[model samples]
Target: MVLKKLVRYIINKYLKDYIEQLDYEKLKLDLKNGHVCLENLHLKPEALTDLSLPVTVATGCLEKFTLIIPWKNLYSMPTKVQIDGFYMLIVPKNGK
Candidate 1:
């Protein structure tokens, strides 16, 4: 009925707004050297597959390590979301 439709519409709107707010807050967090939890988001597939050889070599040369942890490994339960890149690079600060 009309009431059911209205309720559905309101729920959808609230979900959308909540997702946007989460994204904004996440952007403000210091991702550097900190792990990011992407439990309910989907990322581009290309970014997941594409690897730059030069970058890898440079990192190796500089003795820096890059770790890619699958989302499932970080989370206890399987989520409905698939991230573009399952893992995020956490670069340490110069002095740290």
Candidate 2:
């Protein structure tokens, strides 16, 4: 049905714009609360500041696996969403 396709297109567009601040690839929308949630979403790693390290050393670091950033920090960061009082909740994706 044409309506189905249109709805898909709208949701997809909304997702693309929403996740621009996040490094996640997948998301789901909760229509009841108008909340978009991404499981196991990774806050993008800090930009590489130096390139001198060998590839093996880079991959072996634990920071690559997990970061200790706080939940409050995420809500403070800028996002494309302009609505007032937008909120966020970050839990370990799949209890990681």
Per-prediction tally of clashes: 1, 1
Best by TM-score: 2
Error of 1 at 12 (Å): 0.5
Candidate 1 structure quality by residue, lDDT tens digits, 1-96? 553344335434644422322232222111242322323332222222235322211111111112233444557643232234333343332351
Per-residue lDDT for 35 in model 1? 27
Per-residue lDDT, model 1, residue 53, is 24
Tens-digit lDDT track of model 2 for 14-93: 44433324433443443333344444322222222244322211111111212122334557754233223223332222
The TM-score values for the models, in the order shown, are 0.19, 0.23
How close is each model in CA RMSD to the real structure? 16.8, 14.1
Which pairs of residues have clashing backbones in candidate 2? 40-93
Error of 1 at 71 (Å): 41
